[model samples]
Target: MESAVLTQALMRPAAYPHPVSKVTLIETHISQVFLAGAFAYKVRKPVRLAYVNFASLATRHADCEAELRLNRRMAAALYLEVVPIIAGPGPLDVRIGGNGAALEYAVKMRRFRQRDLFSTMAEADQLTGAQIDTLGRQIAAFHESAPVTGHASGHGTPARIAEVMEAALNGVAELASSTEMTGRVAALLRTRAGSLQPAFHKRLASGHIRECHGDLHLGNVALIGQKPTPFDCLEFDEALRWIDTISDTAFLFMDLLHSGRQELAYGLLNAYLECTGDYAGLVVLPFYTAMRAVVRARVLLERAHQRSAAGAITTAEMATTQMRCNDLLDVACFALTRRPGAITIMHGLSGSGKSTVAQRLALAGAMVCVRSDVERQRPPHGHTAGGGDLYAAAQTARVYRRLRAVCCLGSGAGFPMIADATFLARGHRQQFASLAARRVVSFSIVDCNADLATLRERIAARTGQGRDPSDASLQVLALQQRAQEPLGSDEWRHVVRVGEPAAVE
Candidate 1:
């Protein structure tokens, strides 16, 4: 194996024995990727960075194998095998079984078109809520089956988390819009880090820390055969890969928000919670998201520095990069702000704009929403509302009971929460108020009132839409109007109106 042979093979596609009509070479800071026909080959550079070391042939071989093994767990069909680039006596060739000593190792993968990439789809506005839902479910399932890294693993401790945060802050401090802002954020992060020490310890004790896809973002995910598939996980460092499961998810959540897909971010988080029943994870989300933001800013700064040093960056390009870094820092600061906790219950019939208001509130970072329509159609409440016993007296009571119980559980976790439901019965409304009182959280009712004609029209239009979660019809609205109870004088102070200019009663 000679250096000249390996270099020539990398530069010229004619070096390989296979038919190569066209070739493309992609180079990153630490790797070189060659795309030929139907396969992509990745070779790690022989360099040592602060976080990873691939300076020796042995180290490169190990890291290449690690990349292949870890990525195959999620992208099974995409990751093929690690093949050797042998320097034969005549010419360099990629051989399966030969006696020639290998010059380097490359991870061979089944390549798909760039259009299938999630990043590409996002640029084309092709990223959909359904795709985000599939991604959430897939990641949740993967985390559930991942190996747990508990306190014994010593990777997800509070101190370790603080180290990562500090590193990220230092990494991007020079590139930030203001050094004072960076210092303030660093101080705030330290303060919060101390506060979350107990939470980190608790999650570790509960086995919430596990081996994860450390670099989860839009660019790392792709749609293969119309299904969301995550790939290209962090493989060089164990400290990066072994993390709290929620922190792993926060990466994608932050990426979606940064990409201006706020609704999809909320949907993804809600769907993940539905799959894992890990609503408690919400407690650490602010910190996790902030950390993710800092990490992203650091990466952007690194790229900007590299381009500037290479004289490839224009003044406008550098300004845009700086703006992006500033934006991410702002997101971090916003995520760190403590939001008020309250129980906001929506009281209205179907199509009264309750869901719309609740969704808007959730997107505004006010609270996480729990909708009755979506819940009732799932699990034990999987009943066809009409002829079946679903709307029967006892069954209706059970549904409300379940909804109230879910609200209680969510509020107990210390998050601001919105319970979206048609609280037509005084008993049901009072039940939530009492629960909120017991939890020591403020309770408010939003009266999503509209004209009778408007409500009827909306109901009919929604029913015809066919994909709405609610099964309510004009008949349901008539029954509700006759049976609905007005808020008592005692509850007036806590009531708000959604459809009016003035929100409060």
Candidate 2:
């Protein structure tokens, strides 16, 4: 049977055994999704693309099974099963999910509301930081538990990653005459990808590579049961799915930034780092971010070309898609452009609003903030080497050292960073100053201050809320006050003050 005939049958509401008044058939370049009342059935197109080949019945079935198995890893409740599309004896009598020799295979999923999708929320200006925050934590947990690759898979190696990036770049570039993803954008992406091979290999060696949700854009996520549930992972390509966790994160981050939600991007990145403590990813994130943008641009460009060739898209629609693709390319170029780096270290008591200032800088995309309290709590995943003495003098010194290393790495990569901690001692402050000098980046000490009563009240409220990672107590604040050393004249020269209306800038 022809593929279009089967899809036409599935589009009929009567073809479904379940009670449905209408069937909405949404078509993509690779798949046809029939949204029945309570369920949706997806059938892959039997076409060979540069990246994916679903030309044969067997291959389509295998890809369907792969999609079902992999999507169930994170979204168990949404993906129900893979069902066979059977044809009855009568002519033009195709039935959905029945017992017979199958003509096609379909992935059956429980239908979810369109309004709950992250893309929908973002389009309506309803997406929130809290939602992105929750999304970050959930994705972190998922990545930590996802299976690691063996030596033979050859999935996460720099060669394989570059292969995929180059393919995506070329695919988008082929459609460049009709698309706005021009030759210049492709050249920039190629140059940046080539330069970041060492960083990619480093992440792979450090076990940052694993099976990830390769397609982690907003449209693939939904707020199911008040949780940001990710579904529809990339199943056609192993190299795309098996990658550095930061690469997976960079997709959604790029999507948010492209959608003009910078604060949500910062919240998402910060929240994920808080959970996983993978601050080192900050250096190579721009490269990964550009790659993701190219990937997205490929999707848009390819889809527009395919539809135009099929006579399924109007000229106006194709022009609109081209503009969107150009916008994504612009974002790709901007992400790769490096700005002058700087360091901002917080100096204040526990409740003196130091963390607040750090958060503001991060939200503005001015810097990546690393908090001491969060780092002190995580001790090598399972070793627990320093878990028993979080506040011991040696432990504190170790935390400062680690913070300086991360700051230097980020600054060296042309990204500003902030170390969120009470720099009460002169020695701790000097280490960061030395790092800034070595990196040739400007350094500022943000001295956050508030009245004593306000400080105590804020700490009390934070303790009651219990959502903050900080475990600072009243006693800790007392100790911070007594241990605080007055900044010398030299130290005062590099000071930036906060906690005042006009001082933040």
Candidate 3:
């Protein structure tokens, strides 16, 4: 990686106006970043690529400014301002931030520890389910507020999305030596995505297609203030940033799998779905994840190709990168060739860990979950949040029917589904089993049990929380105890017994 004059000058602490004893320079395929003092300055390299052009100083300056503005959307506290590298008295001498004619520009950002980066933490096996869950909720909140593209903008349409995917496939096909599997799996994804044309349009019309963090992945995120914050978005490409929210989500989902964090991937998916209530996105989620993996493989291979052609990487390094690309393609293959879906329903009292078991099962098997409590609490199509028939018999039956429908939707799309509720009645439990039988997918029930003391304690604590969607009271628990129907022997074969142990002193 040969450095230009400005890059070399910027590698010294003296180049920055801040007082620092040393400097560190990091180089990527498209940019050179100089980390010194309490800030990091990123400068795009003078090179043109298929996806971005920074060959000219003017283009690079514009890109730097755009990077600062776009990244501030998510991490406003971290991104500072775009500053110019002014010419010094000497031809090769340059310094950052001045009033002279600019030689190059850099996006100045408040620097955090490299170890805090999600990619680095993941490498150390330090990423936690809690962090991933928080990150998912964060993304959901951001997407909810992100601006939507105008009707005239062609982004997020089937044609526009296909163009992006087709270009990625072409990149992989052109760069990789063996592209048979790539073409095959991609073809299957294309066909599946094609079948969901109306649904995609519906998603677009429903405001699911909005401006988003285009390059969302573990590498672009870091732990800041004990929270995972994202930076370094796809600033130069508006078409990539303005996309379906699920498509943005697929980037992290694919990244987690590529890193072999399968449980975290599922955790992120479940958290995002639960936060946004965007279960319909599950239909095309696998397709988007597959395409994201393909895009990843192409970018890696392309960057490796560029470096190898420039004599920057050794033959052995190039071989290793090729192997990495192959692994990425393998993730894409898994996304496409996933087996038929399964169904699991939670059978327990209100405080018997039904929700907890559903959450765990979702991570264990990449399942989509629907809870009776949440649906019961969720307002009707244009109604205010609450004040409906809290526990009317008709409302309870409606909630059960909706749960079955969500399971059907997810299972039909080849994903495991979890129905979390106190299925004390045989009829409520039978609805999910019947749907599984009709869909020809596997079905099972998780029967959770806890002592009376634990159930009472949990119910009391949850009631105090005031945030739980369940309206069940202590009196309601007593009623459930009396009215609950025990599972008959006929249902034993499909039951997975899970006991919720009483909490310890």
Clashing pairs in 3: none
- Cα miss at 182, model 3 (Å)? 2.3
How well is each residue in 193-306 modelled by candidate 1, as lDDT tens digits?
A: 898888889888888889999999888898888889899899998988999899999999988888887877887887787677576687787788889998888888777776
Global local distance difference test of model 1: 0.79
Please give the CA lDDT of all the candidate structures. Answer: 0.79, 0.85, 0.85
TM-score, each model? 0.78, 0.94, 0.95
Model 2 Cα shift for residue 316 (angstroms): 1.9
Q: How many residue pairs clash per model?
A: 0, 0, 0
Backbone clash pairs for candidate 1 read none
Candidate 3 wrongly placed segments (more than 4 Å): 1-3, 503-505
**Against the correct fold, how does model 1 do in TM-score?**
0.78
| Of 1 and 3, the candidate ranking higher by lDDT | 3
